[model samples]
Target: MRKHWTIVTGLLVIGSVWLTACSDGKSGQSSVDSDKPAEQAKSYANEPAELVIYGAPGDPPEVWNERFGDQLQKKFPNYKFTYIQRSGTNTIENMIASGAQVDLIYDSVGNAVNSVVATGSQLDLSELVKKHNVDMSRFEPATVEAVKQFGGLYGFPVHSGGLVLYYNKAIFDKFGVGYPKDGMTWDEAIELGNKLTRNDNGTQYIGLGQSYIHVLSMNAYSLPFVDKATEKAAINSDKYKKIVDTLIMAPAKAIGYKEQIATLKRLFNNNDFMKERNIAMYVMNFGLQGQKDFESLDWDMAALPVFKDNPGMGTQPYPNFLFISNASKYKDQAMEVLKYVTSDETQLALSKKGYIPVLKNESIKNAFAQDSNVKNKNVVKAVFTNKFASPIARTKYDGKLNSPLQTNLIKAILGEIDLNTALRQTEEEVNKAIEAEKKK
Candidate 1:
């Protein structure tokens, strides 16, 4: 799945009251001017300022253009907005290195936050967040903390995607099994999976299918790849080992095997598993892809099962962040756009397009309530409520460190290496990568 981040700059400090204005011979609503006090009209009226926004490719820019860009163009006659599209973090890294005079950059909080901060391409938005009195009350507390690294706020979130359990409701009903509950444990999920698995004629059904082991790893450890405060590899700890063991040993042992490749192929290609809807559960991110599949099947989503003892340890999800470029001349104007986009109205509007808006206001909740297709409301609500676990610790050298660790993890699951050896090798590789990054 593609992760998108949108950073806005040059937002006007406008009041919260609404105002009416005539534009292009049409009467419409506009925000109150920034010159007014807090008690005044809630519209943004300011001189037009040009802004260069760099964002990930696809629907995000179009949504932004519709919600804020077009409106800003009409509201501020002097401002010209230009949007540049880039795909993937590699492109972003290249653009930054080429001295791209970008005013904003969007990225995920887990992978891109520390890297961007290290590059010094992003500005601290703390003052602007405070000046706008942007309500941080609506966000999941962990999400808020995720955006804050070392004492400065590098970015603000526009939306998030959490982990959820997508199950075939038709298959469950056919087998006389109950649907997965909102809060379930790993053990319980396995039991449910066992009950759901069956064979129809010559085809076999599976209980669970997982695309990414990292998701399982996250649910187990409840931390990012690196500890933000400690700036070190924390995944080799006992807690993480338990997580790794559970995901690998439990499922492999149950099936009487240790090969993940075989498991994946068996789960996906087995006629009864996917084609026949014999599979009970598949763990995936909360995105349009899941919904697209859901539309084709009688499926529903629930929160990923938590650890038996640590009920709080749920799936790890990363939200994209918006940042202001250090090179932008129209910082104030960009800030205004940021503020406008983060507002409750805009957030709610975007939510309709299958995004979990960053704003935690009543408008967002009301919007979700009105949409019947958004069946994963409980999962979303849980994420916002911090019902999930903290992300795995990540280091600045995560690309170097995590890639190898992830590769070895896959190998371990395939039985190419034992769990203890994988862990030891991962520790060695992580320490080496950390050392290399420290030298730089």
Candidate 2:
């Protein structure tokens, strides 16, 4: 029977990697000899197979094909790869719940937390790794450990990256404001942004304003939106309130609260930092491509700002993860694909395209400096200088409960609701969601 490629949506945390999938275009008996070398034997060599690959949001098919698909196809000519577009977290959850015949799931380790693993689609790859004698030690120990923490050998690391503050040097120079330094606290950064915002020649330059979603998603404090133990939204807590208050108030303090509300109504775009050159600092999950986008704009990046109390805690680590589905009929074939993609050769290939290869190999790390468009800048300090905040356990309703924090926070920022009121309202909405999920 021909397998169908499934398209579903899901959200996950940030990381950087290029992913590809390949299988024999047809499902059938293997043509390879059983007595071949173990590595050779597991290749499912010469079988016509079709690999179903489900993508996370923002990964484009063309980019995947260019990055790894063509090369993978050259390595395994008999295997045909199919790419399915991501619709959202809900879509992927539904597909997995329904037992879709997906071969691989691609996303950051964060996004996979409650969605894929909770759905029972993530396969335990410990046995397969042992059978293949794959040297898991070749990759970063932390990345490997991250996958293992998902409660089994649930996934493999592709690459790892994290959030940073990309600032426009020209904007800083124009405003007579100093550039953001690495390790600066959020309060210090905001104070600096207050200096950067001003009217220049009739054009209003935003000191620093990141998207509400970006702010909540990559909060340097890694504040939990839902307390997993209690399975309740923690929006109204003092810590969360402080974090949200700082974020919402900092930009408003910089540009004036009234103006900040007006700007929120219009919504700030990241592109404005580059094309319009009106935004001074854009905090986001920094990748090679994201850095390259600012090359012509005379910009540099600083490490993500730290919280005042948690001086060293930064945004969560984003590691690209590859998960083989438990429902996959071709475990051996899937393992082979995962092994190849995580191989040093493939890691090097992905690094050239701006991904931070998961391999601890110095050779691969050095390669990042060679072709990086922003290598001359402090890319290392910006991306690697900080420590990741502690991770929170995710529940099945985590997304539904957690997702509202962003939108409602946006409402609070836009002055439609007070921060405290917004927090209470979101907490109630999240409680309702949790209750609804329990009934189902």
Candidate 3:
């Protein structure tokens, strides 16, 4: 019989039903000694290797070189570092399909899906984490949970972005309405939206508008995409219906809200809130390097609206995670790089460049608050109020499921079909697709 090791409180020990691994006790002595894996393993810090970074599109090597590449090279003087700019949603998947020599992958959790985990390409870093004595507690609870869903400890977060309400103070002043304050509920936001959503001199001013993607991603109620036990699509449940009703329908009911939202999307589909200046309140994540866009406009952010029932819960977290490819021979070196990038020193350095560092260091948080160019904005509210929902455990066939669901949602919203009928049809269509996928 093979012995299994369990990861308890960030230490590896022989136990039942833990992170599945087949390391003989020949290498382990005790849980206390497990933290020395880095010292026990051969050091590759001086070995010649190129650490490939797969990040967002249009992100030049210079930006990453400045952020952490140079620091990584300084730590491992002999190792070379390079960046592979990601172009589309399937960039990493395409790399995997083509057998690219990928060392490390870093992307938003939204972009980096369960396929990486399901394909057995991402490294299981539980042991590396224990070896490095990385402080798991330093990361936010929600952030840590998000990484664990794909595979236990397969990666770590470098920075996080979450939903917040960006309100134009100038618009509020013009409408004689009080500016939105932190801790406001969705109901309160809608009430305020009613006041500000009107036409002034035929120049339409929409009160509240948030993108569908953001609203769905930041659902206050934690609804799973598929039921765990039956592996069935779970979008037609009462919980999911409430989520749609509150997040989608209620907001659309605001006066001329639909037309105004379409107009905003057409005006600047690039996610520039302040540039338009027509929308009073816009909801979105604190995107990487978007701080400068708000410089010219007099605007501030408020915490994302909470559920009246679930008062403290904000929304699911959005964090960018770093993973090592299982196929890479330099995985040990890649693990070393992963440890360094998510370290306190490295996270603090990146935070200065306008990232929400995953580490829960008081000074980093303070620095973020102090460095805010947008005055009177309670920037930290989103972090404190967040309660992350588990990422949906998806099948490879989900690509088929999302399309019909989204199409029907639009139809329901446009009065082509009722919400109940739409949900029922979506459920049937998705379950059929899941069944077909299982057959394959």
| Top candidate when judged by TM-score against the true structure | 3
lDDT of 2 by residue, 1-440 (tens): 22233222332311111223344211211122245543433446466666767776447766666655666666566665666557644356655544456678877766787557766777788787776556676767667766765677787887786778888888888867788999998888888888878877777887876655556655666566677678788768787788778876557755454464476554565766767777788777766336356557788889888887887878766687878887677677776777777777778877766677777777776666446566687776676667766444434565774456666766776668888888898899989988988898
Best by lDDT: 2
Q: For candidate 3, write residues 1-440 as lDDT tens digits.
A: 21111111111111121111111111111122343543444445556655555654335566666666566655665554555665443355655655555556666666565435655667777776666445577677778777776656777787787777878889999979998877788899888887888888987777776665556645766566666568787788788888777766676666776565455333223244566577788877776226566667777777788888888678677888877766666666676776677666777667665577877677876556444443246676644545555555434444554667766766666667888888889889989988887898
Ranking 1 against 3 by lDDT, winner: 3
Q: Positional deviation of 390 in candidate 3, in angstroms?
A: 4.6
Instruction: List the candidate numbers ranked by lDDT, top first.
Output: 2, 3, 1
* Residue 255 C-alpha lDDT in model 3: 70
Evaluate all candidate structures by whole-model CA lDDT and list the values in order.
0.57, 0.68, 0.64
Give the residue spans of candidate 3 off by over 4 A. 1-44, 56-58, 88-90, 227-232, 259-275, 288-295, 369-376, 385-407, 414-416, 429-440
- lDDT per residue as tens, model 1, 374-400: 545454553443365665544465555
Which pairs, if any, clash in model 3?
none
Candidate 3, residue 13: the lDDT equals: 17
When sorted by TM-score, best at the front, the candidate numbers are 3, 2, 1
Candidate 3 TM-score over all chains jointly: 0.79
